[model samples]
Target chain A: METLDGYLDMDLLRFTTAGSVDDGKSTLIGRLMFDTKTIFEDQLESIERTSRQRGDENVNLALLTDGLRSEREQGITIDVAYRYFATPKRKFIIADTPGHIQYTRNMVTGASTANLAIILVDARKGVIEQTCRHSFIASLLRIEHVVLCVNKMDLVDYAQERFEEIVAAFKAFATRLQIKEITFVPISALHGDNVVNRSANMPWYEGPSLLYHLENVYIGPDSNHVDARFPVQWVIRPHSREHHDYRGYAGRVHGGVFRAGDEVVVLPSGFTTRIRSVERFEGPVEEAFSPMSVVIRLEDDIDVSRGDMIAKPNNQPRVEQELDAMFCWFSPERPLEPGRKYLLRHTTRSVRALVREVRYKVDINTLHKEEGDVQLGLNDIGRIHVRTAEPLLYDSYRRNRLTGGFVLVDEGTNRTVGAGMIR
Target chain B: MTQSYQLSHLDQLESEGIFVLRETAAQFERPCILFSGGKDSIVVARLAQKAFWPARPPLTFLHVDTGHNFPETIEFRDRFLGDLGAQLQVALVQDSIDRGRVVEEKGPNASRNGLQTVTLLDALEEGRFDAAVGGARRDEEKARAKERFFSHRDEFGQWDPKNQRPELWNLFNGRKQTGEHFRVFPLSNWTEMDVWQYILREEIPIPALYFAHEREVIEREGVLLAVTEFLTLREEERTERRTVRFRTVGDATCTGAVESAASTLEAVIEEVASARQTERGGRADDRRSEAAMEDRKRQGYF
Candidate 1:
C-alpha cells in the first residue's frame, strides 16, 4: 500500500457542527476553512462583493457557508450543510446541521456518519432547549465524542466564570444522556478565538483549542474489529472471455477481520464456505478488515446475493423475525402506523416488515418516555417492535452501528419514514 | 502503522455511493443522470460506469445545454460517452425558450443559467425519469451541505429542505412516489481537494479550461471574467489580457475565472493547495447572495 506524506498521512475525521440559528456555527466553519487557507480567491472576492452589497461593515464570514437563498435571507439554517477543511494534522468533514427543533432529523442524519459532534451554545443564552435537543440527538445517534463549544465569549467579556457556568449546566444535563466522551471549550467564532488556534483571552483555561481537539481525538478504534460480518452487495463476475469463472462476493466489511482462508457461513442459508481470495481495486490483498470494500471468492458458491450476510462460522449474528429497537420517525405526511407493512432495509438487504407495536416516545428535552400515545410523528424517537417476512441477520446497534441499523420505507409511497437501530 | 482496519476514506465513500446508485436503479422504473460536464458529475458518471460494468450503464446521461458551454467540455463529454458507448440525451435551453417553457432574461449580460432548471424539469417530465443522478456535492453550499445523498423533489420539482428522508448507515432510501423524482449524489461524501486528488491519481481527462491560459479578460466583482460575446463591457469597464483559468464551468455568462499562472495540472494542484476561498466563490450566480446555491437547488436547479 502506498501512503502519501502530507495529505494521506493526516487521518480523516467527520464531525457535525450544531447550534441554535444564531450561535455562529457557519462562521466557525468559515473561520476554520479560512484560517486553514482552504478558501479560494474567487470565493473571497464574492464574499467581499456580497458584503458590500448587503451594506455590512465587515465581510460576513457566515456568508461563506450560507449556501441557500432562504437560509441567508432568513439568517437561520434549515438543513444540514456539510463543510470540509484540512489542516496539517487531520482532514475534517463538518456536518453543519440546523438548530431548529423541526430539523432534528437532519441532525440525526449528520450524526449518523460523524465520529464527533460539536454542540454550539451562545455564551449569553447558556444551556437552552435546542442545546439539549441537539445533545440528545447526538447521543441517540450514538456519536462517540461531544465537544461543547461555548461560542461568543467576546460577548461575555471573555470571562472565565461565564464559561464555567455554561459548562457546568451542560455537564449536568449531559449526565442523563448515554454519551461516552465530552469536552468543553470557550470560543468566539466570529473573531477567530479558540477555534483553530489557542486563545490568549482565556488564560485561565489550559485545554487545547477546538481544532487541536478535533485533530487529536481518538477515532481510529471506532469500528468493530473483533466480530467479522460481510453483507454481500453483489456477486462480481467480470463475465468476459478471459475471466469466465470469477465469483466474488462484493461488499463493505461491516466488522472484524476476514482472511483468505477464513471459514465463513452464508446467512439465512447457513451454508458454510472458505474464503478463497480477498480482492480490492489494486489487486488481491493478503487480508481484509472492517469497513473495507473487498470482493471475496468462496471455495464453494452457495446462493449468495445482495443483502445476505457472510461472517465467521463461529461468530454468526442471530437470525430473527422480530426486532425491538429505537427509531426516529422521518415523514411529516404519515405517522408510523402499527400493523402496516413497510420495507425494512438492513445493510443492502430489503425485507417486508410489519410494525407490531410502538413501545414509547422519547422526549428530547427532558429525557422522559411518554407512554400509550401510540403515534410517532416527524422527528419523534420511539421504541417499536417489528416482524420481518424474512429473517434478518443482525447485532445490537450498541454493538455495531453498520449491521444493527436499518431504515423503514413506506410500502405505498416508498418514502423513507423512519430509521431503526436494532436492540 | 498497522494497516488501518477500515475502508479507506475514498473507498468507504465509493461503496456507499455505489450502494445508493444501485438502490436508485432498482427502485425507480426510469432513472437518468444530470451530466454537467463537471468533475462531480464526472465522478458520478464513472461510478455508474463501474456500478453496472459488463452491462452498459443502466441509465442515460441528461445534459441541459445552455449553448454557452466551453467547446472543450462539450467535446470531452461526447468523446467520453463515445468511448463508453453510453447513451447521451441533450436538452437544449434555447429550445425551452423557443417553446415558452421558460423566459430568457433580457439584458446586456443576461444569462440562461437559472432558466436551465425549467428545461431540465421539462426533459425529466418528457422522459418520465423518476430519479436523476446529479453531481451536487454537499460541501459546495450551506443549504447543500445539509442536503441528503438522496434529495427528493416534489411534483413541481421543488426541493423541500425542511423535510428530507433520514439516510442511516449505507442504506439509502431512494423510494419516492409517482410524479416525484430524486436527485442522487454519489459523490456527496467527496471534498473539492479529494476530487482533484482523485482526478490526478486516476489521470482522468478534464476540459482544457481548468489549466491556466492567457485570455482577454475583464475584472468584475473582483473576479477576472473572460471577454466573450455573452459579456458586453461598459465604456467604463476595462478589458485586459490576463492569464486566468476556471475552477468551475457553467453557462459561460455566469462563470468567472481567476488570474492564475498554474499551466500544468501539478501546478494547478499546488495552487488549489494554498487557496483560501471556495471554488464557487468565483461563479456570478452564487455571488448573488450567501445562500444562492441553496435557493437554486430548492428550485430544482442542478
Candidate 2:
C-alpha cells in the first residue's frame, strides 16, 4: 500500500477541455484516465457494453464522458460535464464542454473557474476558427495556462512538420490573446500517444506528457495574495448561555493574507476595526489566506452583515455605483438592450441594475469588435455599462475572480440570464 | 516574511464544502442536511459542524429511513447526532407505505430503494424545506456527473436534466418559485478515494460496517449481501458467514458488501486505492438499468 501521508497532502488542479465534436476531446480524457488506471473496471465495462450496443468498430471511449441519456442518444455533449481523476502528485477536475458555436455559453461557464484550458487542434486542420475561439474564451476568462493539444498524430503519420505548422498557426493567433503561458503537446488519443506515457512514434517532439504537465504545472501564483478581501456570507451568533455574546463573521478569503491583528474596514459602511482572531473548526489560526473558510472576530463589531466585505484598511476595493463589464448573454429568449433592468449578484451582494449601454459586441471568430451591432443576443460576448441602485465594493475581474465576477438574474423568470466580469 | 499560499487538496475540498454549506444557510429560509449514516453524509455532517463552529448549524438533518437499514448504521447515526447535539427528523418508508403514499415491492428481489423517493419528497413537502443538502458526488455515477451544485427542482419535485441552469464560478443561483426546492451538493467534486483519504486525515468516525467484519451473508447474482431480516432468500439461496465490508451504505437490501479483511481505516484506504471496480459496482439499485440513477433523480430521489 502507498503511504497515506503523500495522498493526504496533494494539491488540486482544475482544467477545461475545448474542442470541436471531431477533435476527440472525450477520447483524450478517456485515454488520460485509462492510462493512469483511474477508470474503474465497472465503468469501463459499462462503456464497452455501450460501445457494442452502438455497433462501433472499437470500444468507443467517448461513451465514458457523454453521461446524459440525451447526450448518449445524440452522440454529442450539450452541456458541461465534470470529470475527476488523480495522480500521485495532484488531483484533477476536468470541466468537459462541447465546442459548437451555439454552445459558447457552456464553454464560458466551464472556463469560469478553470485554472488552465486544453484546446485540442486537429493536426490535419491546423488552427481553425474553433481553435481561435477556444483560445479567445480561455484568455477572456483570465486562465493563466493553456495547453494546445495537437491530437490525431497517427492520422497524420506522426509528422513533426504537421505538428509544427499547427503550433505556429496557433501561436500567431494566440499572440492576440491574453493567456500567460502556452504549451504544445503532440498526441493521438485513439492510439494513446504522449497522453499519459511518452509516445515512441513522436521521438522528435520533446516535452512532458499531458498528464505530467498537468500534475507539475505551477499554479502557486494564480491566486491573489496581496489584497485581503473577505465577503461575509453568514454570521454565527451562538446566543446560547455558554457563549452568549459570540459574534463570528463567516466567509471565505477571496484575496491576500489576513492575520489576527490586522486592521480591517467594512465595506459600504466604511467602518474600521481590528481582527480579534481567525478561527476554523480546529480553533484560532495565526493567519488566513485566499480560499480558506474561517470565522473572523472583529475587535469592534459595527453591524457587519451578509453581503458586506471585510478588507485591509490600507488597500480597499473600489466603491462605485456604475460598473464597466464584459457580458456574455446566456438567455436565448431575450437580447440585452440598454435601459433594461437586472438583478446583479456579485460577491454575495445582489442589487438592482440597469444596462446603461452596449459598447460593442466582439465577433468570437475574428476577435473583431462591432460597435454598430450593439444588440447582444444569445451566446454573444460584448462590453456593456451597468448602473446599480446602490454602491458596489469590487475589484477588476482580472485582479480577483471571487470579488469581480457576477451574474445577471432576470427577475421575472428568476433565471441567471448573463454573466459579467468587471473591468 | 514570505509564505506559501498553496493549500492541500483536502484543505481545498473542505473549504469549498464549508463555503457551499454557508451559502446554503444564507440563501434559503429553511434548509436541511440529508443525513443517511453513510460515509459521505457523515463527512458532510462533520463539515457542517465546522462550518458553524461554536454555534450549531442552523439547519436540521432529515434522514429518509428506508426501514431496511443496518442496525449498526442506525445506532451510529443516533450516537453521532447526540454527540453533535443536533436535531434530526426521520421520515420512514414504512410510514409512506402505510399511508398509501407509496407501495412496497414484493418478491425475492424486492427492495425499498425506489420507495424512498416518495417518502423523501413527502418529507420535504411536510417540512417545507427550501433546500435539501446532500453528500452526493458527481464521480459516483454518470448521471450525477452533470448535476449542478444547486440543483433546482420544479413545483412537482421533478428534475429537468436537459434544461438545468448554467452554473459559473463560485456564484450559485438558489432563487426559485414557491413549492419548488433545490438539492445542494457540496461534495460534487470529491471522488470516492478523496472521501476515504479525508476520513483518515480528519479521523472522522464512520459505521463499523465500513470496516471488514464477520457477518452472515448470502450470495445473489455474484454479489455478497448481508443476511438481514429485510432480505428474503429463495429456496436455492443459502447463507454463509464471510468477512466482508461495505463500500457504500444504503438500504440493506440493495447495498452489497465486498469480500475483504480490511478492518482499519488505513487498510480500507489501501483497498480503495487499488480496487479495480467502482464503489457502486456492488449496488443492485444502480444496476436496474443504464439510466436508473438519472430516472430516479428526476423523480426527486436523493
Candidate 3:
C-alpha cells in the first residue's frame, strides 16, 4: 500500500454529540467541519444563502446540519444525522442526534455504535435537567468515554470560576454513573473557542483542544480481547466440481483473535473443530481479530450454520433460554406488556421471545427505581425477563456489546419496538 | 508496540459495505442492485462482486434507464454486465410513457428525472422485489445524510423522512411487512473522493464519459450540458466545442459537464480533492429548490 492508502487505513472513531437543540451542538459540528476543511465552498454558500433567507444577521452554523425541510423550518434537529470528518491521525464519524429529552431514543440510536460521547452543557445554565438526562442515557447505553463540553463560555465571559463551578456540579452528579472515562472542555462554538483549536481567551485552562483529544483518544483495548465470540452470519458451501465439499462459516469476529489451526468449538452443538484458514477475497490472512469479517474454513465439517456461534472450547459464553435485560422502549404506538410475544434478534440469531415479567422502570433523571411498573412506554427504560424459544449464546453487555445486545420486533406490526442490553 | 488489529478507514468501509450486501442477500428473497451507470453504482457492483466471489453476485443488477442517458454509459452498462455473466433488468422510461403509465414532460428544462420514479416503482412491484440496493451517499445531499443503511419504505415505495427506523451498529434491521421493502445503500458513508480513490485502487472500469473528452456542449443556468440526441437546443442556445468531462452521469439533458484536461484516474482524484463544489453542484435537478431533494426522496426518487 502507498502512503495515501496507509492514510486511508487510519483508525475510525465514532462518537455521538448530545445537547439541547440550539445549544451550539450543531455549531460545534459545523466548526469541526469548517476547520477540518470537510465543508465544501458551495455547501457553505448554500448555508449562507439559507441564513439570509431566514433573516439572520449572522450566518447560522446550525443551518448546515439541519438538512431536512421540516428540520430547517422548525430550526431544530429532530432525528440523528451522521457526519463524517477526518484528520491526519484518525477518521471520525459523528452521530449528531437531537438533544430533547423526549427524543431519548434518537440519542440511544446514535450512542449505540460510539466509542465516545460529547454531552454539551450551557455554561451559564450549569448542568441542567437535560444534561443529566443525556448523561444517564449515556451511562445506560454503556458509553465508556464521556466529555462534558461546557459550551457558550463567551456568554459567561470565559470566567475560570464559572467553568470550575459547572465542572464540579457535573462531577458531583456523574459519580453515580457507570462511565469509565470522563473529561471536561469549555468551548464557545459560535466563536470557535476550544473546539478545533484552543482559545486564547482561556489562558487559565490547559486541556487539549477538542479536535486534538478526539484524534489522540486511546480506543484500542476497548473490545473484549480475551473472549473470542464469533456469531455465524452466513455459511458458504461451494459444491462445485473442482472445489466440491468446501464449507466455510462466515462472520465478523466480535472479540478476541483467531488464527489458523486454532482449536474452537461450535455453540449449541458443542462440536469441536480446528480452523483451516481465514479467507477474504484478497486472499488468506495470517490472523483475524475483533470486527474483521472473514470466512473460516474448519478442518472438521461440524454442522455449524447461521445463528450458531464459534468460540474456544474452554472460554464459552452463557447458553440460556431465559434472560433478563435492561430494555429501552422505542415505539410510541403501544406500551410493552407481559404475555405478548416478540421476534428477538440477537447477533445473528432470531427466535420467538415471550415477555415473562416487567420488573421495574428507572427514572433516568432521578436514577430512581419505580417498582411495580407493568409497562415500558416510548423512550422509557425498564428491566424485564424474557423467555426465548431457543437457547441464546451471549455475554453481558458490559463484556461484549456485539454478543450481548439484541433488538425486539413487535410481531403484529413488525416494527422494532425496543432494544435490550443483556444483564 | 503491540500488533493493533485495527483496520484502516477504507478497509473498515469495505468490510461494512460487503457485510451489508451479504445481509441483503441473506435477508431478502428477491433483491437487486439499482444500477444507473454512474460511478457510485459501478462501485456498488464491484463491491457486490468481491462480496460473493466464486459465486456470482446473489442479486441482479437492475438499471432504471431514462432513455436520455449518454450513449457511452448505456454501452458500458451492457458490456460490463456481459463481462460479469450476471443478469441485468432494464426498466425503460419510454415504455412507461408509451403505456400511458407516465406522461412525458414538455417545454424547456423538462427532464425525465422525476418521471422515472413511477416506472421504477412499477417495475419493482412487478418484480416483487423486497429490497433494492442503491449507491446514494450521505455527503452527496443533505436529505441523504439522514438516510439509514437499510432505509425502509412503505408498500407504496414512498420514503417517510420523519418516521425512519433507527439503525445502530452493524445490526441493521431488515425486517419489513409483507408488501413493503428496503432501499439498502452500501455506499452511505462514502464520499466522492473515497469512491474515486477506491476506483483507482481496485482498477474498477467505469464509463469513458467520466474522463475528459471533446464534446459539443452549451451553457445554461451556469452549467454545461452535453449535446445529445434527446437534447433539442433553444433558439438562443449555441453549441461550443470544449474539453469537458462529466462529474456525474445522468440524463444528458440535465446532467452537466465540467472543464478538465485530465483523463486518468489519478487526475480525477486530484481534481476531486480540490473540488470547490459538490458532485451535485453541477446537477440541475437538485437546484430546483432548497427542499427539492427532500421532496423527491419522499416521492421515491433515487
Best by DockQ: 2
Clashing pairs in 2: none
DockQ values of all predictions: 0.43, 0.81, 0.62
Residue-level lDDT of model 3, residues A1-423, one tens digit each, is 364665656788889999877588988999898888888887999989878988998888887788788877777788889898877788788998888877888998898988999999989898888888899988878899999999999999999999999989989999999998899999999999999888999999899999888999888655788898888888876566766777777788889888899999999999998999988878888888877778888998678888999999999999999999998899989888888999988888889999899999888788788988468888888899999999999999988888888898887777788899899
Candidate 3 residue lDDT tens string, B1-302: 12777777777778788888878888899999999989999999988887776567878889999999888998999898888767999999999999999988887788999999999999899899999999999888889998999998898899998657777656778888888989999998877877887888789899999899999999998999998887878899999999999999998889989999879987877787778888898998989987889999998887
Ranking by lDDT: 2, 3, 1
lDDT of 2 by residue, A1-423 (tens): 457888888889999998868999999998888878889998888889878988999988877888878778887888899999998898999999999888899999999989999999998888999998999999999999999999999999999999998888888998898988999999999999999888999999889989989999898655799989999999999889997999999999999998998999999899999999999989998889988999999999589999999998899999999999998999988898789999999988989999989999999999999996478999999999999999999999999987889999999888899899999
Give the range of the ten consecutive residues with the poorest summed lDDT in model 3 chain A.
Answer: A1-10
Residue pairs of candidate 3 with colliding backbone atoms? A9-B8
lDDT per residue (tens digit) for residues B153-213 in model 2: 9988899986578888779889999999999999999999989989988888999999999
Q: Candidate 1: where are CA atoms >4 Å away? A: A1-5, A22-27, A38-64, A100-102, A121-132, A152-176, A237-239, A243-247, A372-374, B6-8, B52-56, B92-107, B110-115, B216-241, B287-295
Fill in the DockQ of model 2.
0.81
TM-score of chain A of each: 0.96, 0.98, 0.97
Error of 3 at B85 (Å): 2.9
Fnat of each prediction, in sequence: 0.58, 0.84, 0.55
Q: Which predicted model would earn the best TM-score?
A: 2
